[model samples]
Target chain A: MPTVTLSLGKDSYDVHVMNGALDRLGDLVHRSRLTGHAAIVTDTTVVRHYGERARLALEEAGYTTSLHVVDAGEQSKSLATVETLASELVKAGVDRSGFIVALGGGVVGDLAGFTASIHYRGIPFVQVPTTIMAQVDSSVGGKTAVNIPAGKNLVGSFHQPRLVVVDPLTLTTLPARVIREGMAEMVKHAAIRDAAMLYDIRALAEETELGFTLSTIERLPDLIARNIAIKARVVEEDEKETKDVRAFLNFGHTLGHGIEAAVPYGELLHGEVVSLGMRAALFLSEKYAGLSAHASEDVLSTLKALELPLVLPEGIDPATALEKTLTDKKFQAGMIRFVLLGALGQPTISDDITIDDLKEALALLQRPA
Target chain B: MPTVTLSLGKDSYDVHVMNGALDRLGDLVHRSRLTGHAAIVTDTTVVRHYGERARLALEEAGYTTSLHVVDAGEQSKSLATVETLASELVKAGVDRSGFIVALGGGVVGDLAGFTASIHYRGIPFVQVPTTIMAQVDSSVGGKTAVNIPAGKNLVGSFHQPRLVVVDPLTLTTLPARVIREGMAEMVKHAAIRDAAMLYDIRALAEETELGFTLSTIERLPDLIARNIAIKARVVEEDEKETKDVRAFLNFGHTLGHGIEAAVPYGELLHGEVVSLGMRAALFLSEKYAGLSAHASEDVLSTLKALELPLVLPEGIDPATALEKTLTDKKFQAGMIRFVLLGALGQPTISDDITIDDLKEALALLQRPA
Candidate 1:
């Protein structure tokens, strides 16, 4: 097992990555001293797959486990879902000393984490991420939130999890498309802070089974450990994302969140939108951030080879998309700031772009004739 | 002007108290470096009285001010109120950099503070508390929340305002009953942490005008300053009430919140509920935590003299009222912990009581035959 600690003073917690670590959950929970009733928040898909195993593990560990299965999609990431989960927690008698274990993908992680954040003014929670997307990204950061009607993640809190148990073996049952979607975020982390990891991921993408094989799962522990370490380092220094160090983590998210907002959630997974947004951001970077043409080409090639979306979805108007960007929470002082790539392993925030420039970038993302 | 600083690391802000300082709001905003479009969230009662003055303050401060008025009452401290305020904020194009000024009593402070906390993943806000209850307690604690159907302050965050401007002159137009409501919270603060202040308040409550004369207002800055200091000390140590240091601030809030949750809000102001709750807690403290009989009598005499409620409302079943205390957010391990008075200046939390014990305490609070 590879262990990485996120230093947030008294709110600090550890992220442990290991294949088949789910069996050791009982020990981890024991060591953390979180006792009493445990509420496991997962989704329909996850409950259908490994929910029983997780329940058995917690039961064997001497916890009274209750399951709260939410609808399994991006739509589940809403205040309504958070309310439902909080109500369930209250009904289940989960209190300050009780534990909330989020056992699903990013949607479940975000929703459950947020529910824990506000329930009874906040409670302790553990993140048992069952998807690659969650293990690599959402579970490591304490940025928990629920989407509001006005914007995605517009309602939430920075409530850190007590522990993150990343069991790579859980990803075995994930659909191929889901695996591809998860890789886009990993690719984003690499593009922003780790060039060597990007090179390795690009090489791994060409293999048969698209890097979801058992051997690939073994490599995942290390990859996730490294990605989580990078995120931990950034978040530790700036937990609330106020500083530049934390802002680098939003490499592809400025436009990515806008894209996700423009489209109906569940139609496109967050990583899929992020994949295309990364390409648009790269183009903007090349034009306005003084990035070399080769770097932009490298980004496009990696995204394409991974089978992720590199262009805007059909029927999305450039003007409409540009307008959405302006309204994004990332906008400040009437300027839409973009996290641009200066080079591999480097990211910069820029707001000096004209609407015409963004329009041209969006136009370029249209599907080829 | 008496200025007190709330040192919350990077989130530190100033609490400015002065007579006629509402006119100096322009310079204060400039000092805080908050610019751009601003939204003033106040109730109709306040708008009808001090709206133009607050507007001129922001306008002279170089901010384009937009007003959002809600109904004036504790009933407005609901999620529906928050949603309405949020919609108004969105409609007014209050973006990330925009400032939200909560101007009114505790109701406006809670509603507006919560709206700012959730709007766009949190925005900077200034609390211009126009009521005594607000300046001394709600405005300083960083505990902003909206009541839910399930509980009071069931949904909210610890989003601290960038500045708290308390103009004692604002109290000049406040109704006598409203002034008394504010005094309850002030007395609660003193009873929890400062014996000297409690003694002083006891003396002040006996005077004509309930100590609201110009000399009293001149003495106001220091009294409000001391009450706020007590709260600020507790909050500074534990911003999230996870420890005993922070729970001390909840001295009268356990049963107080239950009463507020049971009654239709606005029927009994927060201070009224807190007053009754404080009496109940004192009886419990005398029985369980070694509170002296003479001290208890002094507490009753002071509250009765202030005309604050010292007994439970008529027809309220003690058992039913006790049930609400069980669901209080402060419960841990199925035990409802409460902050009880050890003496006039000392407060302590105890979980070593039964529902029957609370019922017994409640019986003591029954109306005298």
Candidate 2:
């Protein structure tokens, strides 16, 4: 697959989506002019699979490498984990000139990227995303964060990565559920920015087992790059998420995050909750934004084809989800700025999303239509 | 007495230096176009003195306000304080559009600024620095951090404040020792960028008791602004401190921070150690940078006039101080980027200064002369 460049002027970087890019991680970092120590932050599970391969690749490229692993779960995304990682980085002699290699899924990317953002008031980092969620979405933008008891991603920074290497080959090792989680975001990208990509996604889902079959891995790079490109374009327009255009990316996140918070984290994967959120949003978009039912169904059909969840998991009260939205970062100055679609590929940010509208949409999720 | 505008394009803001700016805090924030809740993060000591004045002023301007106070001291400048303060801001219903008011000395400013930077992934903050050390130095730069056990300012960000309010009247309530601590940075500014300001500083010390006498309060606004402008200009030139020019501000800080770490914090004030460090820097300047003896003495005489310490406190081993420099942030990538003076106003950042040179500078601190 071709490399997609995120045009952030001086902070601009390239996102390389290819079959074997991970093997060239050191070459990529060297090309970006990143020198000094390279601390690879990953997870125990990911380390067992590809850690030694990544270390050898960096060492072969004439870079000193150190592997720092954490427990493989959302529980590791905390201040304590970040503190421990930072101390380990310092112990490894990582300094202002040193850079971090976030070599795992979204959890590793967010944890390590955030660690790099605050260590010595921030240093450059490279993202070697090993999961579909990271390769397509989290890795492209610089929204690094960790969860606190108060909330998820409550503590974070907009520290962009210096380079991103996405190797689709890693997908073969992921669980089927993880692949579906990333597919949910891919469907979101197609729904909001690239309408035609929905057809491609439908075709890809039919051809491969969640886009991870060895025969399908050959096609995974282009599919992942297209999704990443959509994320990059959105980030380039609003690097800090200050502009409302960035809200389009959060079409499902407002309710998705709320419902995700309603459960013990990890009970439902992030993509599963987002899938449910997208379904609710489609219902609201048709009613509140005059979105054509045809466009809405097109998105829902693609989500269904990918086997993404459309119904909320059992035991999650709609009222609890609604209540959680109140404390969400989306609530700006006591106003809910909801993103809706007037048409496929055309998003509108509306403040007209009343609590009644949300309740009605969430109720629609229970019917499983 | 005038406002100093830090020109950083869109991030530019005004630093108001006036006799009673605290009373007009509401008008200033209102003028800046910041709306929503104002969470004033302060210390226990400061809240007792002027917290009500600040709260009432914002309230009178039709803004909702909350007071969040922590214990007063360097100990409060920790990640724990930042976390507790963050939780308080969240409980106060502070959201994305909400702002933070850092209302105290360096500890308060650093802790609050860092808290604001990470809350909701970054929020605007106003620096209401009440100490000369804060008003003339820390408050002007966007350098915010919370110390970890590994090191000081080990975890932080470059999140600049949207506005800064420096009321010289607040200085009158400060102890003479606190007032002298700020003089160390002021002397640093004059020694680096404005040689003539040294004379003004000496004259100011002569007029009132260390520039905090009620009669001398009127003279403080301009003095503080001048020092802040120097800091502001340097920051504009190197917003991230990546450029060599910003290193000039570290003229005495390298050795100063080393010696400060040599003692249990608060035993010798930051400025007292800096005063000693400045003397040692002068000795190095004469030896390594062709600085004239007369030029060095002229600045030394001004520090003496302010009654800032010229001798290292007994019991602080020079070897320990030198050892501490190895871990100081100034030791960039294994080289000491030492700042020295060729003349009173001519400063240079040099990597040529060896560990032996640091030993010599530390030795100079052992002598009272």
Candidate 3:
């Protein structure tokens, strides 16, 4: 197991990147002695694909396993769903001593982890993430939340999982678009913190073996591991986002979340918005952070070659999308803190980013109707 | 200002026991500098009594204050209420940078604490306890939760407050019944951890000074502080109750929660059931822990003199009440773990109590109605 140890004192845990890692979840859980009763929470689509495998792994490890399924989109990441899942867990005899396994993508992970966080004033939970977005991004962080009607992740808690089992093999079944969209996060990781990693990822994107399909990429496990390591380092430095360092991880999320919220929640994938957000950030970087024209060109070319959309999809109004950013959790006192690229790898936080700057940046992402 | 420090490392905080602590809550909250946006979560009844006072204090402290009121009683402690409050907080423009104040007794404290634990994955919160029960017990622990239709506190999280402001002045307006019901917990605390405290409480019970009216208590702040200290010692030893030391604090809660839930939720004040629960535990103590008959009589006399209940209410069934204990959160791997008293001041954990013993003990609490 190539594990990335994310240390947050008592809340620390390992993010294990191993092929077929889901099969070994039983061993990891048993080693930790988390619980004999396991509640596996997954989305409807994921349950059909990985449910039995997950159940078998835990049951063989002497766990009394039960499956709880939610719908397979962002809408399922909600309080009502959490309430229903909790009631089902109670019915399945999952007590305070029982451990919860979030066995899918970010939606399932967020909802299940949030459920476990409050199920009995908190219980042990593990993230068996199946998507690249979740593996390298959401799973390693202790941030768990559900979308309220007012905003995304408006209500939740800082409950860390006991362990994270990242099995890249699970992503093999995902559609190509989902996989490609998830890579946007990896791109953002490189842009914000690691210049060398960005060049490396761009080089890999030029290689023939790096086809968009999961079957074509044997190099993904290593790529994902590097991204997780970068994220793990940042999270270890600031788990609760109190020191503004963790705010670095929210590099593209300000406008990214805004765009995601502006459209129908499930319309454009989360990473797609971030991809558009990154493209817009490059414009902001040039205008505000003294990013070079040559460097911005290189970044745009890399994103284009990787097939990530560089602008908002048709029908999205730039102004409406800009309005959505106002409610961003990043808004403090009254100003929205924007994280812009100072250079290729240097991300800078600016509280002085006016709404006019946001509009100007979003204009670059507006596709003609 | 008299302060009792309840230290649990990162979770530790001071319990300020002052005669007019509520008036200075702004100073304490501001001193900690937890957050500037204050969302005060109180009940309708509470807001009417101290709502203006609370609002003025925080407002004067320069906090942007928003008041969210829930109807009084146990029913208000639900996920629906949490959802509504969260939405209200959002509407009030509370961001993660805000702090929350829980300004009521057990119901408001539990609901508000729970709201804080999950709202924006938790923000800083302060507890301004108004009732004797909350001051002596619930407000000290970080256990925040809501009632699911399945059970009381079946869903929650462990989010400790930055400060617990206990103003004895708030108790002056509490109904006499609420005050007596509260004494049950103080009696239970004395019985389990401190014999001298128990004797002192017994002496207090015999005095004319211990009247059913709230205005009669001239020496309550010290008595309340002593009980909080006993609880503080137990909670410090085990913040999450993993080591079972804190479970000792639940000496009478096994059957107590059952009685509360089996009847109408609002019908039995929590401490009233716990009072009867303490009476039943004494019977079990005699049969299983070799507790002296004289000691049991002394405990009973103390409870009776304090106006706490010794038997189940007129309508609750003995069998139904016993069944509710089966779902106790203290149950691990299907066995209900009971905290019983070995003597007046010796509380110990017991896993060997059979159903026969529980039935026999509970039978003692049956009224002849």
Best candidate, lDDT: 2
lDDT of 2 by residue, A235-298 (tens): 9898998899888999888889888888776788998889889988888999888988999999
Better of 1 and 3 by lDDT: 3
Docking class of 3: medium
Ranking by lDDT: 2, 3, 1
The candidates, ranked best first by DockQ, are 3, 2, 1
Using TM-score as the measure, the top candidate is 2
Q: What is the fnat of candidate 1?
A: 0.42
Off-target runs (Cα >4 Å) in candidate 2 are A207-211, B207-214
**Candidate number that wins on TM-score, 1 or 2:** 2
Of candidates 3 and 2, the better by DockQ? 3
Question: What DockQ number belongs to candidate 3?
Answer: 0.71
Per-residue lDDT tens digits for candidate 1, residues A22-141, read 888877877778888889999999998878888888888899989999998878887667666776777788766677999999989998988787676677899999887898999987
Model 1 lDDT per residue over B117-174, tens place? 7777678999999998998989987888776556567667788999999998898888
For model 1, report DockQ: 0.46
Clashes of each: 0, 0, 3
Clash pairs, model 1 backbone:
none
Return the TM-score for each candidate structure.
0.92, 0.97, 0.95
Better of 2 and 3 by lDDT: 2
